[model samples]
Target: MSNRIYEAYVVHENDQGKYKGNIEKKRVDDLPKHGVLIRVFYSSLNYKDALSATGHKGITNSYPHIPGIDAAGVIEHSDDRRFKEGQNVIVTSFGLGENTPGGYGQYIRVPGDWLVPMPEGLTPFESMVIGTAGFTAALGVYKLRQNDVFPEDGPILVTGATGGVGSLAVAILGRLGYNITAATGKLQKKDYLMMLGARDVIHRDKVKGQSSKPLLQSRWAGVVDTVGGSILDTAIRQTKPNGAVTCCGNILGAELNTNIYPFILRGVSLIGLDSGRCLMPLRKRIWRLLANEWKPTMLEQIAQEVSLSELDGEIKKILRGDQAGRIVVNLNINAQS
Candidate 1:
């Protein structure tokens, strides 16, 4: 591979069983045998990357690992005919950061099918800024669109609105002219949410249903729920008839204390969005949407760039629920600045 010598953030399992991350030199040959070798120009942090970095066994089982779910760059080598060297591409999910060596490294060797050619309206940096978080957010918004939810239908509620997925969802929905009610735990960032196209910004607590009733006041023609658990449950119950809800996160908690009334009575559709497992055709479609008409208007406001050496602190911040927007890692940038 041409992008041979590089560096990566390696997570080590200490003798005491604690995990620590450090920057280390790495080689392209070290990556798993795959069809394409990419020199990643940029990668963006996601909640899953945080988990994998900290050695969450549920997200990653092995050690000496590099965790980054989103990568955008140029191909350095290709065993597959579909992709040629120097071709720009984007790869996210589909085990890139989980079971396989991922974009945290300056280079990634991945399967051919796990790739999507970089869309027309985006550069590598811009694509990483959109990353998996924005892609998933776009997927959720797409589901809302596919289900016939229109801006004129009613306001769309985005739970965890200050987060990566939530904020981007708000931006995309706002770009589409949807009236958005963003529910965030950090209300101090109300202005931030509003700037991202949210017409209304509410506290995350507002979505936590206070009663045991099967349903509540009908609102939200559709919902983009980033946090599962009670917030999602509350949202489903409160959705208007024939409304659709797309769920893409479980940071709040995975257990759902919900029933079927929201489904049978209101015809509320609960669409589970798993970006990693989505078929290629749909994955490419979503990326296209992100690069085109559905692209967020305030893209810069939704993302911040950081060097790889600064990643550890950001990982800690995200795990603490202190992150406000997407964190892009500029692979071309050096640690010493």
Candidate 2:
């Protein structure tokens, strides 16, 4: 038991139910008793983390919590034989940053089954940049491949294009020689989307079907939609016959207000991506692919590094839909080495 006091971003709920977040000192003993103790080196911000930090009851029923869904670090202690001291590992989702204390802290103790050995060819910083958002993107891309959608079929459309998941999906699909079209509300980020390998950029409004028709003209061979609601519905209706569309986030809305004509008439497949509860075998395979074949050439362009103390502004930016790329939190930046 080390007596070290570490700095972490803590969110506390007041008697009136208001939430406040700040950097504070926490002892190692504050961590939950679990299978492995990790000295987190890096973590990344996601939309879900923003919600958890801001007291979204749906994401976090309890407060006085640390919110960071993605973490990459080295093991300090282990109760399970599968993990040993000093081994590099990663943890994402599986109730992290929600009910459990998460990576906003310098240390986290979680079950061995929740950890993945850092794959070869990827650094801790790189892994966090590809965190939950990138993992979800990979899952969406995997579904497209599973449904037999290929680069030669036609253009692949990615909704929420400037977001972490959508941007990563664009990059991955581009790396595979696919024709990529990105849809975003932020037209100013046209160059950024193009740099991420999007062959074309379309206003998000164009993808939001205007008519009340159940199905629209086929426009995409495959779709990776991070925004739900109209964008998801539009993607489904506009998908080419036999095309696949993978849905992940619901930042827009949860309801799918579309008719069955897209599915029944066009044979369109709407696959759902859930990185949080994904099986270990599939998770491992996806990580391996991200490290290898699907690895983005412009990874650094997609990430901005920040210290733990600088998370507040980024959190606000993300919540307001102003953030265009990944924000990685470097825990070791100011830590005693």
Candidate 3:
């Protein structure tokens, strides 16, 4: 216990193209010297983590790196005046777990600007549960609202509704009094989506079947789309006049094949969501909303907690698209805890 070395899930790729990830002992001094050192207690898994762990150079260019994009803990040391020892904070996005060692480790040293004071009313576990995914969900809604879209306008469609971002979006929108329609390719998850407060759960195939006739039925006021490609195209075409659609992920496909008819004829807006580089002012505002009014009523139900030892199996499950909701990793747990 006197040793300062900590444990972390470090990833490595061999020259032969093989990849490996395991818990390795790391010393406190080994972490990069920077603004603040956080004794990370909890972190959450995301699609980007799966990509980085499996050697997706687009998401992570370096090897032997830790892969965790979201973390919540207390400050151990800080070179900046804004943070001090023992203060709880959460860090996400900002090149974390990408080129930089991420929350997969029990400790992280990052720039002062990268840390956000943990919002009031959220425990470390709760913050991790609402990590980057929750942040992105809130961002989608925030953008729509900024464009004057409101719950009274019309029903909002949330695609990829079974994923972390999508599930939380549904819950938040439902709590905000929006009529939410959850769309998922997994028919088996109908009840799960409904429990997240979605007014209705529909199969993805149904939406895909809608006619791509420039602009079709004017059905929605706003859209929170996590599945890109044809579903996004369809959502755009189906949205009502003056509606907005936030595109956040490429889970279905990166290519967005669509036309200008939705925009030209219906005056629809296609807003791109970038949770990673959102301005600090906006990031803080979004976090405040997540901790308060925009908080998802189903946050606990939509999150699963796991330890570092069990992450390997869970990571594989996530990569295969079998995981629903958020996966929070507890890094400081003792054997029994």
RMSD of each: 1.6, 1.1, 1.8
The TM-score values for the models, in the order shown, are 0.97, 0.98, 0.97
Among all windows of ten consecutive residues in candidate 1, which has the lowest summed lDDT?
328-337
* lDDT of candidate 1 over 114-209, digit per residue (tens): 999998998898898788888888989889989999999999999999889998998999999999999988999999998999999988888886
Which has the greatest TM-score? 2
Evaluate residue 320 in candidate 2 and report its C-alpha lDDT on the 0 to 100 scale: 93
Best prediction by lDDT: 2
Candidate models: Cα lDDT each? 0.89, 0.92, 0.89
Q: Measured by C-alpha RMSD in angstroms, how accurate is candidate 1? A: 1.6
Which pairs clash in the backbone of model 1? Answer: none
Candidate 3 structure quality by residue, lDDT tens digits, 1-337: 2246888988899999978898888887778866798888999999899889889999999788899999899998889999999999989999999998899998889999998898897889988888999899999999999888998899999999999899889988988999999998787998888888888888988777477587778889999999898899999999999999999998788998899999988889999999999999999988988889988878788888888888888889988989999999999764321
Off by over 4 Å in 2: none
What count of clashes does model 2 give? Answer: 0
Instruction: List ranges where model 3 is wrong by over 4 Å.
Output: 1-3, 334-337
Task: In angstroms, give how far residue 32 of model 1 lies from its true place.
Answer: 2.0
User: Of 1 and 2, which scores higher on TM-score?
Assistant: 2
Sorting all predicted structures by TM-score, with the top scorer first, yields: 2, 1, 3
